[model samples]
Target: MNSNNEGKMDVLNNIDDQFKELLELIEKEKVSSFSMKHFDRLKKKRKTSKKKWFIIGFLILTLISMYFILLNEQLTYNIYFVFLSFVRLILIKKCVNTTEIIKQSNITFFNFTKSIYLNHLPVIIDDATDSWPAMKELTLKKLFQLFIEDPVLAENDLCYFETNIRNYNQAEGADRLFNDYINGKRRSFIGQWNNCKRETLKVIRSYYNKPYFLPPSVTQTLMGNWFLVSAGFHKGTDYLHRIPLNYDWVWLAQIQGSSLIELRPKHPCETICSILKSVTLNKGDLSNDCFFLAKESYWTR
Candidate 1:
């Protein structure tokens, strides 16, 4: 009976030793897995650092090459001009294609709005103002006669009178002689008149009828509270101002005279100090008058 008890105790001790060995093996495997994860993370970090260094090195090399190429006196200016010319040609081609599409497609006001909204591109519609009574009656002579007859319209507070026809520099407190200015220098003036004012509304109603191509639905969405009448005497005069950045769209109708318009793309990363494209509009050419619809993301001159 004593020998049987001793054999049972020995079996129990062997089973305890085997369980401790299995626990130690599990601990070693946990440590190995942790180390492998740490090594993988380090390897990934090293690869990212190498990629950044390679990009930096490539940029430096490119700058050095450009510097050497520009150092040559004869090729420097010529190369710069050549590159500019190439860019200009590409822009001109784009303008020509756009113009051709408009001419060929017979784009109406509805389609024009759709195209601009969907593509966010600028468009020029010719002969848009042919039906306007202002096109036929609002010559420089007739405008002066109308203003002379009505002092209120001529000297309204909202009217902007400029001595320099070329720019917006106002003639500091200069006497506004309507007849003299119109007859003499024929300088341009912009009058703020809309349908809200009874007196001006009468005048606007006579000549500035709603465009036939514009649907009533589109008219409802337009910012119609303010309407400006811009009259200029000189040929090259322009009103240059940046459109408010918040505005998504703008339309300019040329009432009279010829104009040269230049436009450039606005980019967040770059300053646009140059014009990308320039187009000249002449009287009764292309269209009797033109309407330019532009996305506010474009800078116009």
Candidate 2:
């Protein structure tokens, strides 16, 4: 009877063990469910935050736009008063008005000249990255000052310099910034004039730097004496006509602080690499085989 009781006790312990295992399993499942629910809720919150921010931004933009419309009405009225004041001043300031009148006439004439001469020039060719803008590219008025202040440039060269700078502003894709930059003139028109001045300076520099090419005796004789020059023509054979390359080219250009100097092209996109390989400049030469073959067509511009 004692042995039978011991066996019955063992069986009871085994049953208890099974029950405990089942409880542990159930607890684990419950924990997993809670974690899953938390993950789902967190995902929802992230989605909601993104949408909420978007809505807030949209509302802010709408309010700002409305404010501008209201402001524009006042601005338009102010412009009319300002214009009227200008007209009265023009009528009264005869000397001031006369200078302005002549300036306007000159501008109109310059525009006409650009329409004829730079007809082939793309409007989108923006200004060069000139570091010394004031001294180098931004010095057209200085040209007028030169004749007034220092030596004089030949009439023909002087004319081209003036016109080129004027037309440089006409470069395509630069209308807005051009107008914003110029002051003491119509915001829109004046900026274009300033841009034109800068562009003209770049073109003038490129023209003068034609390799081994010198101007007429008068120009050579009067180097610094001449302020500007017309780029007549460059050797077509020196460079390939076209270089077919898949490249976003950013040229290393020089800017001066009241100075100008000649530099050679460092990157030879096509055949120029081969031609300039032998012609090294300042220890940097655009001489590479694959590059030269690529630009194997017309080289001169």
Which prediction has the highest lDDT against the true structure?
1
My TM-score estimates for the predictions, one after another, are 0.44, 0.24
lDDT of the candidates, in the order given = 0.46, 0.30
lDDT of 1 at 85: 38
The Cα error of candidate 1 at residue 33, in Å, is: 70
lDDT of 2 at 93: 22
lDDT of 2 at 43: 94
lDDT of 2 by residue, 68-150 (tens): 74456434334433453344333332222111001111123245223311221111111223122332433333333333333
TM-score result, candidate 2:
0.24
Candidate 2's C-alpha runs over 4 A off are 74-301
Model 1, TM vs. native: 0.44
Q: Per-residue lDDT for 85 in model 2?
A: 36
